[model samples]
Target: MSESNTPEQNSQPASATPPKQESLLANLLINIAIPALILAKLSGDDWLGTKWAIVVALAFPLLYGLRDFLQNGKANFFSGLGVVSILLTGGISLMELDAKYIAMKEAAIPALLGIATVVSLRTRWPLVKTFLYNDKVLDTDKIAAKLEDNNNLGAFELTLKQASWMVAASFFLSSVLNYVLAKVILTSPPGSEAFNAELGKMTALSYPVIVVPSMIVLILAMVFLFRRIGKLTGLKLEDIMAAHHR
Candidate 1:
């Protein structure tokens, strides 16, 4: 009877099964569905007045807030600001039927992100670090020891700071380019004309053209900086990416 009881205790029932992996539904919604809806709505003939455009543009940040709430339990300040800026500029364009707001939209998103990046660098919180890498399992003592021994914390902070500045600078330059394109190439007026021409150009170019290149440049620069720093610190790019994915 003891032998029989031991077998019963050791053997588990076959009815239980492992939990299913989480779906990629949210990723789909954000990356594909939302952008599609925004593009479709913007392309439509219906009048997207200033108020409506503002409301719609504001939705981006709100959605991001919702995403943060669901995923991380906190709203991201920088991402929220970027969303708001995009909406503000986009709304302005829609209301006046000008293209300046639309053109500015291209510049606004990156600029806002850049600002957020700078603000985040000032704190010991490592806000961007949290976003790009998962440091949850990191040993505080180890990290503290590393920070103490290495004089490179200042350098690391500067790298992040400069990277953020670069993003803002790039966006500012892009905005200026768009402005010039509107005034000289498209013959757009300062306010409404520029807005309209900018919208037309954005429509033709698409958001990817503007966003992808900027991000690519930013990431590449960051990677190069990371590599240089890592060589000195004995860290690896894979380590950063793994932390980010987690």
Candidate 2:
């Protein structure tokens, strides 16, 4: 007769490792960055103009800096600066009760982000790429090695260019759209009830209009560019993701 196996041993699968926790940076970008941006922009309106809103909006960067500090015992200096800048700007705007200052806050953030992104692209560091993709997997070194071995220098450069352009475009477009909406709201003639109603609708939709389309466009652009880069360099997405994880 054949030997019988125990239930515990027989039921176990060959590979049984648990999933890894998400990296801190990934959590920050997804859960903190986008929502903070939305809150900072929306908090500009007079009706929603509470001091607490400004505090909450500014807390995202602070929390990110705190996480960095806890993880490495050294916070990103610029990240800390960004938190301070947001708080100072919000405080001054609140004290003055100037709606324009609040409106301009949205414009300022995107510009700062664009500048930072451009600076990062100029370096070999690939800071934003590291922040977004690093620690997502466990094979980052292999991916980097593949990128180097594939020798598609042109494709790599194109990826950087596309990313820089997208960052700048998102900033400028969001700022322009927000400015236009603010102008319409501030300039609507008194007693034009129909215009006021339409303005309300536009204002309500403005955040979604700017954010959703920009994000979709950014995603599509990255997908197309990454695919082209993969074909040119003979590197797969899995390879890149793995490389970054290391």
TM-score of every candidate relative to the true structure: 0.53, 0.55
Between which residue pairs do clashes occur in model 2?
139-242, 140-242, 140-243, 140-244, 140-246, 143-243
> Where does model 1 exceed 4 Å of error?
1-72, 115-144, 150-164, 167-206, 236-246
Please report how far candidate 2 places residue 32 from its true position, in Å. 11
Which pairs of residues collide in model 1? 50-95, 98-195, 98-196, 99-195, 99-196, 100-195, 134-243
Q: Where's the lowest-lDDT run of ten residues in candidate 2?
A: 12-21
**Which candidate gets the maximum lDDT versus the true structure?**
2
Clashes of each: 7, 6
